[model samples]
Target: MKTKIFGHRGSAGTHPENTMISFKEAARVGADGIELDIQMTKDGVIVVIHDETVKRTTNGKDKGWVKDYTLKQLKKMDASYKFKDQYGICEIPTLEEVFDWAKSNQLLINVEFKTGLVAYKGIEEKTLKMINDYGLEDRIVLSSFNHYSLVKCRQLSSTIDLAILYMEGLYEPWDYAKRLHTNGIHPYHQTINKEIVDESIRNGIAVRPFTINDEKKMKEFIDYGCSAIITDHPKMAAALIK
Candidate 1:
């Protein structure tokens, strides 16, 4: 099969990361999928954003933590102000909004739980329930650097595809994934090599590397036969694959 291109934070190279504008642009530019981060707001709402702090993506001056604000408060912040003006005003979208948008499309959604930094209680249950409610169980893949959270997710649903994300080398990531009963492994792009990709393929586990932006590097991973690549430049990657 051809390698798949998943927009990392939804065409983040040219748009506000994790905002609806970026997601739409990724689809418009022919990305096979989109990778986004999720965290729970103070009101227990699942919000789509990458960082624990809203300062980086939003126009908030004090650098508010997502956990410290309610969904209403978060929605009020302008998430696209830092980006080029063409992106227009963007708000932090609730996970439900994303699901509603995704239901009509064929794009794969890689939802990374932002639990490695802040472990929101009941986030796993909430996420699983929401995914099921949206009827996106098959089209969504849950990933996190927190392996325990992934195990908790499996405890709730056996069929939800899960992937373990790590930034460092692993002895045998496929084996670890097997133990976790996950279907895939997400390694940092720089950590992947031909041997790792081959082993993952042989083991029937998907190998997806993250944040790949360079054209040459994207082609290298494709040549290594990666199952998918999460990149800030999904349009560029899609063009290269063609």
Candidate 2:
């Protein structure tokens, strides 16, 4: 079977990362799903963004004030973040805003709990509630490098498809999944090879790679039967998949 394609931060290659504009663009280009990162704000609101700091994605003067600011304050900050001169005015999007966008579409959503100066506790429950509010229990997947978050989601909703995200070789993911009872593993794209890929397939564990943009490298993983790829360049991936 062909692998499913998810837009990393909503095809971040086209628009600024984590904005609804980017998600809209990804869906416009036929992405099967969107990969989103979640973080809790200072006011206990769940917002969609990638980095621990807002400075990277927003034109914030300070680096660590993302959560210190309210959701409205976050929206007021310009999200036209430029690293290499590519400009896009993307505002911060709330979890509800994203779910509203996904409600009537065929777009599957993967919400990654990204914690770094903030505790990810209760984020899983909040995310699950948001998904349920939209009646998208079957159309969304929740993943996290924090095994506890994924486990908590399972505790809250067993029927929810869970995926473990790992950056390093901390443990045998297949064994971890078996112990944790997760259905999928979403690992950093560069960490995979033929051996591990084959092993995942043999073990009946779904493997999806992250942030892959190189065409040649993408084909190699697809040839190895990858379950999916969370990518920055969905158009490139679409062409490669074709």
Candidate 3:
């Protein structure tokens, strides 16, 4: 099968990571999927963002922890602070807003739960319910660094796809994934090679490496027949694949 390309944080190299404009740019560039991180707000609303703190990506006056702000408070901050001169202000988008936008397109959504740092109680259930409500289970892939959270997600829903996110090399990670009831693995780009990809595929596990921005590495992994690659430059990957 031809390898797929997923936009990392929605073309993060060009647009502000995790913002709606970034996601739209990914789709416009013909990306097959878009990967994003989600963190819960103080009121239990799921919002798209990478950092646990707003200081890194936003122009909020407080620049506090994400969990400490309500959705309304969070929206007032400019998520595109880095690109403010170019894109003006961009509000942090809610998962629901993204879902509503995604419904109009065919892009697959890989939602990474940011629970490894702060365990947002009921985040799994809330996200799952929203996916189901939007009838997007088939297009959504839930992944996390927290294996326990992945297990909880498995207990909640057996059909939706789950992938383990790891930065280190693990022995026979496919087997480990099987034990966790997950079907896919998202490893750091440097942690995998041809042998591991072959082994994982042999065991019915899909391997998709992350944050591969270099042209050489992108071509190498695609040639290796990886299930997918997450990259900050989807346009470049798409051109190479074609």
Tell me the whole-model lDDT of each prediction, alpha carbons only: 0.92, 0.81, 0.94
Positional deviation of residue 37's Cα in model 2 after best superposition, in angstroms: 0.7
Q: Lowest summed lDDT over 10 consecutive residues: which window, candidate 2?
A: 80-89
lDDT of 2: 0.81
Off by over 4 Å in 2: 83-88
lDDT of 3 at 30: 85
Tens digits of per-residue lDDT for model 1, 134-200: 8889889999999999999999999999999999989888999999999999999878789989998
TM-score of each: 0.97, 0.92, 0.99
Off by over 4 Å in 1: none
Better of 1 and 2 by TM-score: 1
Q: Which candidate, 2 or 3, would have the higher TM-score against the true structure?
A: 3
Task: Pick out the ten consecutive residues of candidate 1 with the lowest summed lDDT.
Answer: 80-89
lDDT of 2 by residue, 201-228 (tens): 6787889888788888778888888888
The number of the candidate with the highest lDDT is 3
